[model samples]
Target: MAKGQVFVSMALALLVFMHVGGIRGEMRGGGEEGDRILALPGQPKVSFQQFSGYVTVNKVVGRALFYWLTEAVHDPLSKPLVVWLNGGPGCSSVAYGASEEIGPFRINKTASGLYLNKFPWNTEANLLFLETPAGVGFSYTNRSSDLFDTGDRRTAKDSLQFLIQWMDRFPRYKTREVYLTGESYAGHYVPQLAKEIVTYNAISKHPIYLKGFMVGNAVTDNYYDNLGTVTYWWSHAMISDRTYRQLINICDFSRLKESNECESLYSYAMDQEFGNIDQYNIYAPPCNNSDGRTNGCTRHTIRLPHRPHPIFRQMSGYDPCTEKYAEIFYNRPDVQKAMHANTTKIPYKWTACNEVLNRNWNDTDVSILPIYRDLIAAGLRIWVFSGDVDSVVPVTATRYSLAQLKLSTKIPWYPWYVKKQVGGWTEVYEGLTFATVRGAGHEVPLFKPRATLQLFRSFLSGQPLPTKS
Candidate 1:
């Protein structure tokens, strides 16, 4: 053949090879194969493949859960799968965990774009984020009744179903080591889901392998959480002695909203503690232009502008309005299409937390300590890390809950180092482990990404956090 013809043939062969081996559009899991995102709108170009779509957990309830999965930066097949859930009992993992915390891309300032995260959790392992239960973010149900009535058991079981079906789609992961972790109310969700997986595995011949689980700044025990929260407020000089006294004397976390005194006192305390401050990050700066808005992004204590898409948003200096940016990004029609989300076109806009589910959230247990004990006994790796500055589910509460366990220390408490600095303190026990993120708040990875990543690396490796940098 002529040289020109040979060159053309070679080029065609290269194109075919790249199409087959290329990283951009390969579908890994089989189910909902059409769900593969060819490319996200405005997403920075990268080689890794990402999948986002809904997994129907219950057809009767018309319940479907939304998920976003990013394979490990390298050798995803070799890396263990780490499933992350964000607590709120009503929050979206995709919103808080994926967009704002440790996901690969941070929502750009324009809300119509994305930016690469310098410290994405996907670098260490496959990151799977699910917007669980129903009526939370992109996850929803056709039955309005289910939307308003979400509880721990339903949430856990649904999460399990989602996972089992997800494994079916990605059959290769059926036996892959799975580690469950979550924060906030997920303190309850992760343990409960792990428990369900264990129960399911007891009957199934091929079980979803469970190596360990983790919860960060979680609501493990209600009484302790409340107690720690009040103490945190007062200790941080956020509340007065009188308000603290009221919290001490009258507040019961189990029915925190029922008692007029408890509700009123806590409201007053929050007013004092949260005035112009980020409730999620007490010292973080308030939004510059969005501040003082009456009814936008206020639940997360964020101030958002009236613009359809705020152009003044920033991706730098830890912007307080990141959640607003995320809301805008996730709600965009093109972005949704690229993500394969909002399949049914839910009536309402996507928000960080589901108020309907939050209002009706049925917390069965005051504490998850008993579940932690049981998992520990089962020889599952259990690690609990707390961002010390989180007043919502204060480290004090976490310590108090673990103290109730009375597990002997396998490794005496010591500061874990990261980059030659004290990242946090860690304690290894006979059954479980606990650590503190030195200056982080409710969202550990958001405030201390590097340190949290290091903590994560240690947990995944089943090794103790470093004592020296």
Candidate 2:
């Protein structure tokens, strides 16, 4: 054949090869087949596909993040992608976001099997739960110092890298609208990562389809969070009048470092005055199992700046301890092998939260409100919802921080209903929506699944929360 004829043949062959490999259009990565989860041990059979594996964010330092994608129940192709992160500065999204809050499977307390969550967010959209920053959950790093050096800045950058690479692996989702969601410290993670996505989209030939972000009881401004937390404690009668006055007069939250006196007072309130209560959900009973393991309640907290306070884990109901079950289920050899996790066989057992990483956290933004402002001005759909009963990152604190934005209220605060009953109250601002889950704690989905699902639906549709019954 002539040289021109041979060139045309080669070009056609290349196109065929790309199409067969699922790389047509804007798709650019591989490994989808290998990552497909056939069946997790003891998991209930479900129709939708599930994929979980690691995505290397850095080669030199050998850092990789783990992710579990639970596709939509009905028509995944028509659904948007929603990414969920949990904040402990070190908590595993696989544990909290996946097993307890929004993901489809809920681990049985016996750790022997899995059950379906009737209100799983995957029912509405494709859910992506990530264990990020290289030290959380099954995600790991070859370099030992990476654990000691992690903070908000590095976490956000690394997460952005993970997304860029992950989208390549599941290239079909490249064009799907993506929304970032998380709670607590993810308030920092979600917005900071959103800023990074917005920045990356401005310069990249193939940008992520980032739509917006929503956070629950997120840590926004340290000053406002601290002020609101103290106020919540006082208003709820968790502390004495004298203690409240002392906290207000002494704690200087504007500063990066809280004084020793401030720390002592705060610690005293939590330890002495707070009693044996679930700080995550004050109205709930504390898990008092002897091992602190049987009840499935794993203690987790987000220490802000220099204030270290112990808080409760995110589980369901009055005293449900679901995290212990997650730890047992995830650490099982068969389960890990099935999910493609712990491939490196790091020298440790999987835990819900990494204390070392959380303790050694190097830096924090002190406030994430600046990034929120930037994203809001960029016309992204930004929503901040709070589970009112949480004292750790209370609704009061969220209100205080958002008040600083001074966005004109487009819709006055009104009751939002689900199933003809008041689910919560919502108020729309010029570029943001603030809603409250009436009786929920820090983790809204865990505490109030149906209401949160309704909230989630509203967020995805870019519609206001239902004002009518």
Candidate 3:
């Protein structure tokens, strides 16, 4: 062949190689032949082995299972089992639950250490955090074409299957008291999963010991959620009464649609100039750059514009608390090894904001109230707690959603006092209790560790929430 011909042939071969490599990368986990259980990095020095179990649903896609940090903890046979999930429709519980909130430990502020939380929920229970559905966290799919358009029903089913396989892996915990807890989006996840567990227990003769569920600042109803936020903003003076009234007129709380009206209303609120209003008093404004430029708004920025908010000052105190813990955690090599977290990955500072993931969550739909009602009827304890400063899922929104239950408020609405003041309020009917967390926002655990722990303790004990006057 001539030199020109040879050069053409070589170029063609290179193109083929690149194309083949790309295809292979995409196909790695789509089929039965390619399914796998992923190994977590930097295993804790403790005794637990990170195990993977596959739940074969269809021929193409299988569920990636994550088991305990067994090496670090005790024997499963002797402990109660709790399955924890973080809501995002796409979030990993291991990433958020284990790293940020009520896990056994909190990641150091610098992501360089592990500090034992004074109020770790797992201390009282054997906790297992799951990255659910097919695409969350370490969970994977062999099919590259698998739909990421997950809804509540699909997630509930996948989680139910995961539980079945998980129990089989650690059969000792099958009869142990099993509680499901999650924050934010897990509001939808927990109820649906519990409903499935209850339904399966009735039909299969093998009952999973599902005792109760807890959701913090969960997204229960979109309409009520928006309305509550507006009210919160007005109450906190985040927006003037004039702006709040405009928001009410322009935005329809009943329908959750991304319309020009909603956008314009939000834009007006964001752009509205207030004279000498304390930004610290309300949550900070949303960043305008949209390029994932800023770290999360300062705690003040994150707070909803509102007056008389419980946790207004608490946001500013997080950094000091996080720093105090980081110092202790980073000093321990064992903890560092267990997290396998890249200290450099810590953002502008080590706070819990992951802009990429947070942005993606905007598309998620959380409509699982029916599931909650179903679980309540099946005799499961359901508790919803809201951080007063979280405008996204404000306390008012939570109360609005509960009001729709029309359950004839058995106990009527009452104040829930902490420290001799009305820290928040609670209302109970049937087995469901909706309460507010005083001095807390979206991430309740970080803001009010003591109050958050108290809520969890009450949940685990199966006791009715205390009424405050």
TM-score sort, best first: 2, 1, 3
Question: Who wins the lDDT comparison?
Answer: 2
lDDT tens digits, residue span 183-290, model 2: 988988999999999999999999898999999989899899989988998999999999999999998978666788987887788767877777677886655556
Better of 1 and 3 by lDDT: 1
Residue-level lDDT of model 3, residues 35-107, one tens digit each, is 2223322223433333322443343454343323422255645556777777655555665666556776555
Q: Tell me which residue pairs clash in candidate 1.
A: none
- Ordering by lDDT: 2, 1, 3
lDDT tens string, model 1, 219-320? 777676667767777888878888788778886765534477666775666555556555555665445554545221332221100011121222255665
RMSD of each: 11.9, 11.4, 9.6
- The Cα error of candidate 2 at residue 39, in Å, is 0.9
| lDDT of predicted model 3 | 0.57
TM-score of each: 0.86, 0.89, 0.72
Best candidate according to TM-score: 2
Clashing pairs in 2: 296-321, 297-321
**lDDT, candidates in the order shown:** 0.74, 0.81, 0.57
